[model samples]
Target: MGKVGPPITGLPVMPSDLPLDEVPEDVLREVLEEEKRIYRNRSYKKKPYPTSRDVMEAVREALRVSTRIHPDEFPDVVLHILESKGFEVRHVTVKRIWRAYETLVRKGVIRDELGVMM
Candidate 1:
């Protein structure tokens, strides 16, 4: 009877080490061309910055949905929601939103109750 042995695990065989500069010229040219093609097809997209109106709307929405959330945590939550919505809102933009909210409250456009704007 043949001796039993552990089953072979077909792990991926890595390519043998070969420095790029030492590779054949044809293969190196093909690699460089592939890299260039990949770079050409890549998207360098940027998120659009939210306008003042967008910021105000987001802040209002955040306030409406955050009744159970603490007032001190509102800014971070609002920033996250806005960013997830594809708005390029930053930490500074949170301050802008707060200022806008304050203005709205001062002008009686929005009512403030216990730090949560309504």
Candidate 2:
């Protein structure tokens, strides 16, 4: 009968050498071309922004309230209050509110909060 060996033991061995510092030229070129193709496809596409009716209604409410109150006087506070009142006023939902806030800031409705437009 052939000699039998004992079961393997201890931790597995690892490679002693490090990988290449940079990708090979051909591979890099292929990656770059793929990225360019993806960019071109995305650029040609007309991506739509958020435009929910509930969000629009929230924006209208903000606009109506903003007209009477100074936007800068307390933009965050006012928004918080409206949110507390259950306006569903999320940054995502109130994109129009952000736009109106920016307009209000430009029109002196509120001081520029960190100069953020939205």
Worst 10 residues of 2 by lDDT: 13-22
Per residue, candidate 2 scores C-alpha lDDT tens digits across 1-118 of: 3333443675453322324444489987898999999998877543233344443344455555655554454346545645555554455424455665565567775565444554
In the predicted model 2, the residue pairs found to clash are 72-110, 72-111
Off by over 4 Å in 1: 1-16, 114-118
Global lDDT of each model?
A: 0.72, 0.53
- TM-scores of the candidates are 0.71, 0.27
TM-score of 2: 0.27
**Against the hidden true structure, what lDDT does model 1 obtain?**
0.72
Name every residue pair that clashes in candidate 1.
none
For model 1, residues 1-118, the per-residue Cα lDDT tens digits are 3333444575543344333455689988898999999998896798888877777777778878776777678778778778878977654455686787787788886677436554
Cα deviation of 94, candidate 2, in Å:
4.0
Q: Going through the candidates in order, what is the number of backbone clashes in each?
A: 0, 2
lDDT of 1 at 83: 86
